[model samples]
Target: MTGDQTRKLALVRNEVDLSEGDFDPTLLAVRVEEAARRLSIGRTTMYALIRDGAVQTVPIGRSRRVPVQALSDYLAQRMQSRPINAVA
Candidate 1:
């Protein structure tokens, strides 16, 4: 990855302060790769989820940006549907 990509990945993985709130202006929407990294998943899998409507994306001009809320909602739905007592 280029330095810029690495920096973005780092931002996705570590920069956010969870205690503050979810509405960070800088993170309102992030690149697909950043969203995937935030969710600890592969970029291809993130795109698949987007294509399947399990996750949401917003188009800005010609680029696709994944809303931070969408990722949270998708994870919430997945957690809700997970089988209780399933092996961790």
Candidate 2:
């Protein structure tokens, strides 16, 4: 990752205050931008994922929030579909 991306990831990690694992149980949901940062994806790509149903979100007032579990699920599904030993 580039320096800027690393810095951003650090910022996101600090903001989320992750404990012993990849996610913090206390944080049930996060803003779209935060979710994007957590996934190391651009905002547009994140939105595209949502649009494509690869990622899920919840409506909150006038804003949309991505559930922390949704992120985990997305990652798990992706890993399942593309195994580490699979050829490109």
Candidate 3:
């Protein structure tokens, strides 16, 4: 990875904070970059969203994870502006 990519990954790795011994498996988890990539967005945008609370993320150990449901909900919220039955 390039220095920027490594830094982005490390920054993401550090922002996640959690405690205790277990996690809620009912939630879905994905790497920060992967999540942004899925949305056709970039890493910086992902970090910005997390910082701005536009989306929710969960911390698992030293790695940060974006819950699938959270991403889905975010997209749903955005999709509200579109017509429900609009054909593509």
> For this target, which candidate reaches the highest lDDT against the unseen true structure?
2
Deviation from native of the Cα of residue 55 in model 2, angstroms: 0.5
- Using Cα atoms with residue i matched to residue i, what is each candidate's TM-score against the true structure? 0.68, 0.68, 0.59
- Candidate 1's clash total is 0
Model 3, 1-88: lDDT tens digits are 8986665555444443322322233435777776786677888999999899989998888877998788888899878978989775
Query: Across residues 1-88, which tens digit of lDDT does each residue of candidate 1 receive?
Result: 9986776666666564443434234668887877887787898999999999999999988988899999899989988898977675
Per-residue lDDT over 1-88 for candidate 2, one digit per residue giving the tens place of the 0 to 100 score: 9986676566545564433345534668887877887888899999999999999999988888999999999999988999699885
Off by over 4 Å in 3: 1-27, 81-88
lDDT of each: 0.79, 0.81, 0.72
Candidate 2 Cα outliers beyond 4 Å, as residue runs: 1-25, 86-88
**Between the candidate structures 1 and 3, which one is better when assessed by TM-score?**
1
Pick the winner on lDDT between candidates 2 and 3: 2
Q: Model 2 misses residue 71 by how many Å?
A: 0.3
Q: Enumerate clash totals for all models, in the order shown.
A: 0, 0, 0
- Candidate 2 has its poorest 10 consecutive residues by lDDT at 16-25
Model 3 lDDT, residue 21, Cα: 26
- Model 1 regions lying over 4 Å from their true place: 1-25
